[model samples]
Target: MHTSPLITIQAITKSFKGVKAVDNLTLSVGYNEYVALLGPNGAGKTTLVEMIEGLQKPDSGSITIQGKTWQKDAAFLRTIMGISLQETKFTDKMTVSEVLDLFGSFYKLGKKVTRQILQTIRLEEKAKAYVVTLSGGQRQKLALGVAMLNNPQLLLLDEPTTGLDPNARREIWDILMQLKKERGTSMILTTHYMEEAAYLCDRIVIIDKGKILADDTLATLLTSYDPGEVIAFQVSSPLATNSLYEIRGVKDVHWIEEGVKGMLTVESITHTLPVLLNLVESSGNTITSFESRKKTLDDLFRTMTGRSLHE
Candidate 1:
């Protein structure tokens, strides 16, 4: 038997002031799949999300959720979709429970559902706390709780943990992971944090200038687009950058500090490292610092786009 994807976007294009924000993009999300939409600022990630969320209409092509178009099935679609934007504001005077209760009422949900959502978001203790008194992370959890009230099958989170500290961010991740494990929720997350996307999403789609540059599992993207171990080292003295490329398995060399500090993308560190060290020693340049690690999504993004995710 064959099953359709949870959401389908077909060659959708959107423009603003004669500038295309999303240029003939096509994408899909499967049932229970968690996808991360990663790109730099003005990359049209938000624009694409807005169209999916029914907040914007594309100039051309179509978007369908569970094979239903937003133009015709919006009423039914709204019931199955949950959205947590980059920032959600609550009345400062409203308690956490009250906030959830208010949103839940829109769906005609009962107190029982509110209790469960509070527990699911790990904010039961803060149920009585006012929104103004809650921490930034707690507020985000509340926003997530509100989004989850409908028991939505699809979740859309836009930079949900952008400003939180590491500990706070992990808390959000834990809650999201729980949702995926327990309820099999499909999700589309837009974020600037490579680690967050790497940790949470099963598939990553990197978009730039309203176009998808790379889309695949993290490991596959690394291996297919730019495969190699990264060797970053600092030397005691300058050396010819071109000479490093002569080593076997060395694919690319980037000089962070001209000839003194450099990084190498090599097919095999075992083959390249020894030769690199010998060359440096023979050239009378002592190694000051060295690190070798597997190439990461951040490295892949830089290779494809020539810019960092945050940039």
Candidate 2:
């Protein structure tokens, strides 16, 4: 039997001041799926997400969650999803437990569920700690805990770890992975971090100029679009870009800092690296630093859009 998708969007469009923020876009999310929406700022990721969340209405087309439209099923739709925005603020006087209990109360949940939520977010030790005293990461966990109070089936997270440090970001990732593993929660996460999207999402959708440029699994995106390995290095002296391209297996060369620092996309490192080194050495251009790795989503995005995710 074929089951319907958990969320369905068809040709939805939204505009502001005669400018289309989300141009005729269609997308779907499957049950128990984790999807990441990656795009540069002003790419309409947030606009699309807002429409899906029923926080905003599209100018045209339709959005349905579990086959229910927001116009008619707004109440029921609210019950099944949890949202964690880029930033969440809580009263400074409220303790961690108190904050959870307060949000839980909105869903008519009690102390037992609140206790479980604290444990799930690993904030049991900070139950008595005031919200103001919590670190940035702990505050994010609390925001996540509040979102999960309803035991929502679908989670909408908008850059939940945006300002967090690496260690703090990993902690947020761990909690989200746990939720997906134990509860089978479906999620739509919007993030600026390629590493976060690659690690946490099963499917990645890259949007630009209010349109999806690439949508697929990480491997497919990497392979289908200019499949290759990446070599990034700096040299003691400037090197001609055309010279690097002459190496066998070299597909493309991108200079990060004119000729002194650059990255190359090659069909095989084994074939390209030795030749590249010999050429550099013969030309009297010593390598300052060198590294090689598999092509990543970051590379794919740059290839397609000619811009970095942060740019």
Candidate 3:
């Protein structure tokens, strides 16, 4: 059995000043799926998102939201979609509640959802604080509250926690996770942080130069693009680099320093870890620290695009 996607983008193309921001890109989001859209600065992430949001028109292509076209059903589109951009500036004097009320007024729905949204975003305590007085994370939370005023089915978030501190970012992530769990909102998040994508999204869509480079679940992407585990360790004494390579299941070894620490990409940790430990111990060297993890989306992006996601 197959079901139609909740949102579909077909061969969308957009350009600015002879530069193709989005070059015949197409994608789809399933119902209640959290997808992360990732790309470098010039990769057209913002352009593509705007086109889907109906803020920018594509030169050529079709965007359908729940089988509704923006051209024919713009009002309906507004009612069902919530967008939180990287930065949203409100009147400095307006309080959090005031800002949410102003955005809520745009829709026919009244103040019923405001309290719920405030509670969801954990801004109930600071509801009376002016927008200018709120911390960066709180302001971001208010922005999310405003976006959710219509109780949208589709949520488009653009770098929702770009500059926030670790604690604030975690707070935002927690709020978003709770919302997804409770409302099942289909969300498309655009972020440079690979950890954010891995933590929140069911699938990852990597784009480069206006085209999708890869799209798959985080596990699938890791397995398909970077199928291996990296074991990194620091030793009290140096072991010969060639000796490390001779360990079972070690496909490759990269020394961070000739005599201090190094990393190994292995085919099977079960086969390699014990052998590695034994080798280090037998060679009169003690491992000061050891850790291992499979390759991540960050590695996949670098492999495919030869550039950092933040570039």
Candidate 4:
């Protein structure tokens, strides 16, 4: 099976108050593909996707969908694209069903599509519940349901799990995976959670400030960076100071005094932890416990940005 590129963004740039927000950003999303847009806050992710949705125009460049997506022909594109943003703009008093029905009116979809969306979002029980009464998770589900009312071929999710509890976030993640399976819907997912990005996206675009820092499959992205790994254990004080250099793959081992904190950092995950553990045990140090610390997306993002995702 073959499909055309669903969206093309060429050198798209945007600025606010003379400060550049998006800088020469270029990306292409293939149809039925899942792409994770990851970066710390203020990374211009929202600005970039808005331009692709035709809600905002780029300062200098082009955004092209398969067909015209301007407001003039939005009626046509509406059927092919669904968008769920981090912010939910629901009127406090409106019932879930009322809001869903209202949004459905904008798309001219029939009951079949609306009903299916409601079921997929698991809002049937809360269909008549007021928006204010639903939990944050249910509200987010409703937002997704509304987005899918038109049976969109492409879905754009902007930090879909923001502010969600761990359980709610996991629920939404499962739903997204299911959508890709049942509908074969192409999705552009933006998030600050590296774990979620690593879990959901087949490929990822890592942006820092206003530049594309890395773009590749999750494995490639992890492998290409020196984000590395660490193996840490707490035990009795070490008998030998020079043993630091003896542990295999210990890129740098500086034993610090956190009461009983003992640590060995391996530069690469390719390094074996058994050797480090064996050294700790044989050294007469109490082998209290140990864990391998692989370089997560957060580690990579923080390494590049020098700040946490929330920062």
Candidate 5:
């Protein structure tokens, strides 16, 4: 592996009918590192990855793999880059092993390597299984395995766990981490799940509407928000939520449990405690339980965007 960034995208912009889908986007993935490209729908992440994969060309700027432009050396880049898209299409009649063999043929994978990949992906038993008979998770693993058939230097995965159950998701994460440790493959992945991004990504890049909103280590970006504390209480009465919102220094009050319960985020817990106590006194809203905690990424995103990431 090169002792440098595996991929470099410099001010890349792609347009569709004069509308820029990827707006002057600049990103890089270093050798043996993993990064997450996270954004809501229409964030231009997929378009950007497509450009890097040479499925499309940028209107401006450049994409390079190990200092060689994708335009100049598409075949060489293809040898080093492995991509697993949001969806994988295979011949319905192909068995797991047969399908893998097809990809291996293209990449010229050795028998020893193909055998290892099957085992690495836990598809050894599914070798005789037809691709169409596999579950969503199984097919996903197969898709990933096919992508890695070349023993790629870089892996790009787009929403690899979108339709997986919790167990399957965790299983995929284990496999990915294994690949990271054993192969030292640089990776760039796109996903909408913040929790997944937090756990898998060495660095997270948050984007929206073709522009970057935040990009850094999760902890570093989270610290950019206010250091406010929060205490969520279950209100015993209907009027409590709005009453708490009226308290001083309370920026936003959310009725997380509807009228009977809520979470209030405030400036300073010490100063806000008296305000909350006073509100409880005047509104006669009983508190059944309470919890206090520091600011979090979810809250920070909500504060800035006026909507949760899921929203």
Candidate 6:
């Protein structure tokens, strides 16, 4: 509900040689908002983040963090912002405490990263352990702790939970939620995990091929762009595709054949299930199994981008 913009990208365009990487991209993150930058590989997400981080300059446009542009306030911005990249490689010889101390020293007015920060990241017990001895999840938590050592107002997290096990990922999510609640820290997250974005983000900005595909809250996006449910069923015999198309209120019907059995996807489950079942029964076909689910981020992504997230 905070209306003040904490981060803004205005008319941003970045190119490599002759090809555009980010085309006229305009995005903003409000104070205390959690926004996700979602896209597939080669979708200009990295390029856009790099521009915001000031690691790469855009071909044309402007980026401001907390009403200050990088060119005019690079040093001051570093104090107010924290960035955690996808992969952080720390010295194997350093203990967790040593790593935190090292990062904390870089800021002029950085908060003293104490045992509480370690406990917050759930790494207090591992404080004395060497960096190389930590598991992937622990290392990631430590990296997050380092990013937050300065007690930044804006946190930029890039794929924070990628490559983590479910339990480990959930731990990170809990920590993030705790931070959001306790500190009201604004965050801009870049991730491919749809469920993570849905659960953690207030708004999702979907980018593809250097363009913004959709920018809105998940509920709004799903309800407006993708409505209804998908009912799937397995049959003992191949379903008559022609008869499926005749079901009243059915938006679309698709099926897959596996030897003598088949699976179908019907868009209108509530309106078509009863009629479709009767029609299949009358046609001498038996349904072996059935399931139905509301349309999710996967379906919406495929609908917009013409491919799955992995592709």
Best-fitting candidate, measured by lDDT? 2
lDDT of 6 by residue, 1-311 (tens): 54559998999999998878999999998887899989999888888987888888988989988789989999898888888887789999999988887787776433344566787898878989999999988988888887788888988888888889999899888988888898999898889999999999999999998899999999998888867677767778776566667777665554445423333344567777888689878978888888888877776787787676778
Candidate 4 to native Cα RMSD, angstroms: 3.9
TM-score of 1: 0.95
lDDT (Cα, tens digit) per residue for candidate 4, span 95-117? 88788778888877666667777
For each candidate in turn, the TM-score is 0.95, 0.94, 0.83, 0.82, 0.87, 0.89
List residue ranges in candidate 4 displaced over 4 A.
1-3, 67-73, 232-265, 268-291
RMSD of each: 1.6, 1.6, 3.6, 3.9, 3.0, 2.7
Candidate 5 structure lDDT: 0.81
Q: What residue pairs clash in candidate 6, if any at all?
A: none
lDDT of 1 by residue, 1-311 (tens): 22989999999999999889999999999998999999998999999998999999999989989889888999999999999887788999999999999999999999999999999889989999999999888898888899899999999998899888998899889988988999999999999998998899999999999999988998788888888899999999898978998998998888889899988999999989999999999998899999999998877877887666766
Quote model 6's TM-score.
0.89
Clashing pairs in 5: none
TM-score of model number 2: 0.94
Return the clash pairs for model 2, or none: none
Task: Give the whole-model CA lDDT for all candidates, comma-separated.
Answer: 0.91, 0.91, 0.86, 0.77, 0.81, 0.82
Compare candidates 3 and 6 on TM-score and give the better one.
Answer: 6
Whole-model lDDT, candidate 6? 0.82
> Distance from true position, residue 136, model 3, in Å?
0.7
lDDT of 2: 0.91
lDDT of 1 at 232: 92
